[model samples]
Target: MSLTLYALGVAVLLSASFFYLFGYRSWRRRRVMAKPFPADWQTILDRDVWVYRHLPEPLQARLRPLIQVFLDEKRFYGCAGLTVTDTMRVTIAAEACLLILNLPLSFYDDLRAILVYPSAYRVPDIHREGEVLSESSGVHLGDSWQRGKVILSWEDVVAGAGHHQHGHNVAIHEFTHQLDQADGSADGAPMLRSSNALRTWSQVFSKAFDNLQKTLEQGHSELIDPYGATNPAEFFAVVTETFFERPRALHREHPALYRQLQQFFDLDPLSWTRAGD
Candidate 1:
């Protein structure tokens, strides 16, 4: 064959291979979503993930496939001799899936593993006491790592998941961190589509976060958790917990903040019926 013709044929073959390589991953995920959701898994979600019960019927249908794909693609490991069960997996996946129900993302594509402890676990953390910086282990209910991991206390998960009105879901809190840390450690803002969106988010979140910090410093804060005052990262996660678990209160208290979350999430959770503990 002519040398030029041979080179053209090789280029065509490489192009086809590239397309197939990427296309196959998308196809595999679709196949995972297509598998019929098991009855046992559905029951687990209904029982543990109270928020799952409140999703709009269409969204509920949309979320199940996401849960399936998450369980399929991500690895889950039990900690402290705890054995990860279907109830734990379904409950955790259900809440995390809600964060991406409307977004055109690959179901937390950067995340890979979820570590669940039976209860509160301790990890290396730092604390400043009396002007002294001390490095020590701190007991935490949950935390997210930018390097493709999330750690949770299953005990807290069950409590937070079952009480939708309390505005304290560890699953939602940690996953929001994952979203905020799209590019790196949680920086209070996720990747926005445009500079205008980023600017708007910055303005709205800054004002609201400032207000929250000031109010918390003065006295007992209600509706929005005081933990949001820790920093912008925690502010984003804490408010996300309030946004989903206590939408009415968040909207009534921080209207601008509520609207910002609504715009980014593309869902007005204000309509969902809040469950009583």
Candidate 2:
């Protein structure tokens, strides 16, 4: 054989070895993560997360693996002198995974880290003045970035988890933003299963948003929080919070909008309501 041919064969062997090792390591890591769900974590979810308790037992079983994989894939950091705990991790993961419980799990794959603050934290707001940008800071309960980071106030997370029917869950709200960002733009639209689905969603959401705006202007009480009327992206996130947190109210007040969310999420939270009763 020619020297060049021998060298080529050796290179192919090395490449195969490298790939095999990498794949093996990944399989081993996932095997470890697949271990039975921890009892302490179950205790945390039971004690802290009201929504989890409302879920049917089979759905709870399905959600457990999603939570485990979520905890395995994402990293958490404590900011503002807060010490992160297992309870915090499990609580956050459970709430966040609740959004994608019925959808494919790939939606959150781009998300890499979650930064938790002890309370509402200040983030600088940048205003572009043509030639320069001005900065001012304001306190925020939570924020999601397109670059794979989510910031949350630990206090608000705890409150939101406990108060399941208040139409306010920071974890669910921010994670929905992550879902919106999955398609490379936070434009209140995630990648739907089909173009037809997108059209239906667009028509329903646009009409709902307009009606919501009109209702807010008329100073009438709305089932969805007024904060959702801010923008399409915020509207999606805000309504997502209400969908999971207060499903019955959403279904009753905005049946069309609630159906759109149900189709997109592929889960009927209203059934959970009936189950709870």
| Alpha-carbon TM-score of each model against the true structure | 0.89, 0.89
Name the runs in model 1 displaced over 4 angstroms.
Answer: 1-21, 127-133, 274-277
lDDT of 2 by residue, 74-170 (tens): 9999998889999899999999999888887778878999999999999899889899989999999999999999999999999999868878999
| lDDT (Cα atoms) of all candidates against the true structure | 0.88, 0.90
The lowest-lDDT stretch of 10 consecutive residues in candidate 2 is 24-33
lDDT value, candidate 2, whole model = 0.90
After superposition on all C-alphas, the RMSD of every candidate to the true structure, in Å, is 3.4, 3.2
**Candidate 1: which pairs clash?**
none
lDDT of 1 at 276: 31
